[model samples]
Target: MEFWIIVALTSVIVTLAVAWPLLRAPKKSTELTDDYDMRVYRDQLSEVDHDLARGVLSEEEAKQVRTEVSRRVLAADASASTSAAEIRIDSSRKTNLTALAVMAVFLLGGASGTYYLIGSAGTADQPLAQRLSALQTARDNRLSQKEVETRVGNITEMEDKATDDYKKLVAKLREAVKQRPDDLRGLNFLVQNEARLGRFAAAHQAKSRAITISGSKATGTDYTDLAELMIIAAGGYVSPEAEAALAQAFAKDPEDPRARYYSGLDLAQNGRADIAYKVWINLLDEGPEDAPWIAPIRGQIADVALMAGIRLAPPPPLAGPTADQIKNAANMSEKDRRKLINGMVRQLSERLASGGGTADEWARLIRAYGVLGETEKAKKIWGEAKLKFASNAKGLGLIKEAATSAGVAD
Candidate 1:
């Protein structure tokens, strides 16, 4: 109320300031000049002199006429000279007043029109507390039930045939996981390798089993894995099961990059770019730095940001894994290989949570985890990888292969 009052008062003051100049009548038009009349009297005196010189009038008569004419000329000059200056000043004042009137009309009309069309002319300000609550509500509403139902992801079933050697390796790995069903690593690997081979149902099964084994110890990432596998198994749709899994993951950690990214992506897919933009912005602000999702978010945000009435700048390009880092694990001993592989996988998981990476890189990272039986991590990678490579036929194929090799073949 106070703020509005101030705005109203300022507008009034400006209007009056403009109107005052135009409303007041200028000083009365300057008295008419006598300069022309004075010139006429002088001409009469000259005529009298010429007549006398031509002997058309006697000297006495000529003298009287000349004196009268001279006196009239002097009177005319005195009066007109005094008034001329006043006329100019009066004209100038009227011109200035006219200008002010034109400006005032434009100013008042423009301000009023703009306020009527776009300004919050009569609304009260929302208090900070209320505003914050509204913001949270809006952000939470970004992922709607309708959206969850309508925007079943671009879940394509992988149908690529595996090579003979990889198929043999996969068969052996599956047997190993089956022999030791309690083996967390085996279950994890089974999920990825099965997924890569397009065994989506198997992948989902392995993921659920992995989660069950973790039981009370399961983390946000754990549920995220199962939810992702559910999405894949459902042909890119976020099924009720997948949505339930996502809810669990979000409940565990709202700021988890994977949850945030997928939630925003879901909103975007459902034609709620406005909500998605806000979700991504919040994710950018609160998620871990240099997370993988940042890259993809940066790539996808421009259109959504525009819809959301926000400006977006490109986030700094992420530096990808070094050639040696990607290859070093191959030559490492079992313990060293596990440590490097996990480190890279964790980094990739976090980075990708926001979204960015090539198909090959995504494939490699998913494969790394699939080999290690970290079904949960491979599931996260597979969920986002499908989105990232949706447009790239070759890349998508590579991802499918890696998903199968990792046992996440769905």
Candidate 2:
């Protein structure tokens, strides 16, 4: 577009230059051609005056014809000077100027529109680096979308086919990884599925290859995660070297919560409950309040508590009625129901405050209250359960009960 605009402007200049000379040349040429004629007419007029002055003819005849001859000579000169060439040149110049103006308008207008249209894609308000980044991002997104679609198709094919299906999937995924070694999706899928099929060694090999392929391939968190999964798939055994890998990853990035969580799992699995207990307790302190890992983390804590024989405060007995005593309560009068509830609540309250109930016992006690519809007593138990089981689901049966009791509608 820029090249064409320059060419057009150059052409316009050339046209104007060529046409200016042509338009002016005709008039100049006509004047030169008529010079001799004008000179002859002037001489003839002078000769007539001379003839009349020298008594060659009457003064009256000279005077009468002088004005007429002068008029005819001026008219003839005007006709000769303004020739067809001059009229044609003048008309051509006018046409050329009109064309040049039109061309200028179109060239500038088209260029301006094109400039803005191209510029509007990113906008000048953005830095050049940012524009380039955005362009790369958009291109990558398009390519990634296509890749995901292809992978979905591959997954469908794998689902439908049955002949060494897992191996075939791995082969295809390996080929894709080879085609785009930097692509994490193919490598990750390959490793996960290989592990799923109990091919831990192969998955480890693929992960190692991927780590080699992309120079900056192994992130601390991802590397530890993959290595740990490999170790688990390898029948829960790993060498000192494998341990060193996790230690190195943690050293490289100590702040990664997953690394911390898995480290605790490894400690627990290896029967270092003391170390595991310490690690998990610290993890609970450092991790997000609602981390899903907390469920397993708290379960481990409860297991530790059981190992140490640390018992929680016993929950109150069933208030109002027991689940099995529902018919008994129904058979009794309204007064009996109130008496039964008061006795149960008092006994349960004493036990809960005394602190000797196991986790399971608390769950059963709360469930008993719920079955009897002693909701007020159940709600109290539920609140206490939430605190006791803040991290573990076992103690949190009360939260569900609490929600139902509040009538907030699931």
Candidate 3:
């Protein structure tokens, strides 16, 4: 009741302030007119008399000046009445009143019309509440369905590196996963996208759920991904849980590149460099030449290999056996094929480190280092190559590309 009273009072005040001009009648101005001139003439006659009494003017001269002034005043008085009447504009007065009424209608009508179009008047009695509510409603309506999904529904939406299209895909995947939480396909997307999105915690959770859903079908890659996520989530520290995940991955696929790489890393940290050396050297011999993990393997393998009575070779150029090469060696066993590949890699590395290859070759060597996850070695090579090719723009460009690929560019 008090609110209503306040509102009613406010409305009355606004109405008066807005329409006062239309409601009031026009008043004539109190300016100098014929009547005023009569008074002014009388005052001048008195001043002339005072001047004569004080002997400032001769009696005759004062009288003559007063007479002339009186005559002019009478004429001015007649003109003043006409001038005053001419200023009274009845037509203009009516026009102004009408215009004021029209303006008041527009101002009040606009306010009411705006309220009716978007206001919550029909829903509630509180007139002021709609103003705040409208703002919130507008903001809520601004977000597209896809935007909402990307911001909240999908874990991968948080990844800074993900493309907008990719983020949308992740959002759709999130919706699908929500609908079927037990689906392996959904969980797989959840794992991969989440990791790519850099949300390691979510990635680990998704990987765990995936393993649970997959049961015995969960592959080494899945477990490895989970372990890697765990390591990342723990800020590169291989926690006990990560250790467990790594073991599980090894159990499923002992030859998994990432799994073997991380295992070697852990082993080296645990003062088992000899074992780590064996693990990495074997990975180099069998793993895909372009694998991301191989760079790190090739980089750190040297120290451990030396400690384990083995020579760690320099990184080879980024190349692997061609289909033709494999076909030519088809008569050889799988072990032989791998051995030949490893030997080729070893030969290339030796040439890069000592045989003084071309600028392109050096760049290839750096790229190979990157592929093997040997960022430090790649950086070192980059420094040396810069000195060698400082004046050569083409060579420098190649080296820059290689360094960038290796994750070693300054």
Candidate 4:
């Protein structure tokens, strides 16, 4: 009610200001008809008489000058009378009260209607400090990894799709790790196989053990892997435990993509979509298209941008294998699929070597070599990327993230 009252008052004040000129009586024309001009003509007539007395002008000349001055005086008087009559007529004319009313109504009604339609009518004012406090409270109250997992149910269904040989291998690996619990290599293998089989809880446990064993030698990737498994286990929720792991990853390497992506997720879930949107948008723009986080970031970024009060367009699709080509590869033999992948990798490598592609493309090449178990090539590419982006901190960060994922970064 108070808001409406203030708005009404303001509108009235503005309307009065705008209409004030038209509301008052018009001033009489003050130009050319004042007594000053008549005085000047009278002085000219006196000058004519003085000139005649001093014999400077003939009698005929004096008579002619006086006649001209008198004629001008009469003409000016007539113009002044006509102007006064027009002024009187104007003053007597009625004001356009209807137009004034319409203007006032439009100003008030238009503004009120616009506010009612789009403004938050009756919602309590939320100051910056209050909003920040609320976000902090939400963060403090967020669900833990265990709680989220319970809500989403167990995520071990991928084990059903494992082949018999793969299952036997994973089972043997698990036993091997059980027998030699302190062996980091065995633990790492167990974590990979468990995650492949969709036993994310077990995978994260194994990864945590490996990180503990490695201690000071553990890379950011180790903590990132642990966080990734936890998030997967919790059905994509970045739990408190996962956030802690991501923090550890950042402590090791601030450029770690997995850690950065998960941290952004945590921020978004805790009601800081503005910050999250910046993080995710940068990650998407600087992507090695095959980064594990790319697909998920792409999927959620549009919605996140909207939440942050941004109208972002979806990024153009990255150049890659088409749907038809991917479908064809699915039916190919393992060797054939590997050959196709190798061909694609070779093309990217050649492009980067000859044409000097973007930092993201270079990163993609390094990560692809890592995927193919060509660590030597990945390391060489990582070295070249460092030199190429020597002066560019952001580009180096992006490339370093891929190198870390490829096990080639220092």
Question: Candidate 4 residues 279-317, lDDT tens each?
Answer: 987887888876766755654666578778999764443
Which stretches in model 1 have alpha-carbon errors above 4 Å? 1-13, 19-75, 117-128, 139-154, 159-190, 197-209, 216-224, 227-298, 301-386, 389-410
Better-scoring candidate (TM-score), 2 or 4:
4
Using all chains and alpha carbons, the TM-scores for the candidates as numbered come to 0.47, 0.34, 0.37, 0.56
Worst 10 residues of 3 by lDDT: 148-157
Question: Which residue segments of model 4 deviate by more than 4 Å?
Answer: 26-95, 154-157, 168-185, 277-306, 309-410
Question: What lDDT score belongs to each candidate, Candidate 1 first?
Answer: 0.72, 0.59, 0.69, 0.81
lDDT of 1 by residue, 22-81 (tens): 666545444666456766787788888899999999999998888888787777776677
Error of 1 at 21 (Å): 4.9
How would the candidate models be sorted by TM-score, starting from the highest?
4, 1, 3, 2
| lDDT (10s digit) by residue, model 2, range 166-209 | 56867787788779877766787787776655455566667766
Please tell me which model should have the higher lDDT, number 1 or number 2. 1
In candidate 1, how many Å is residue 325 off? 35
Best by TM-score: 4
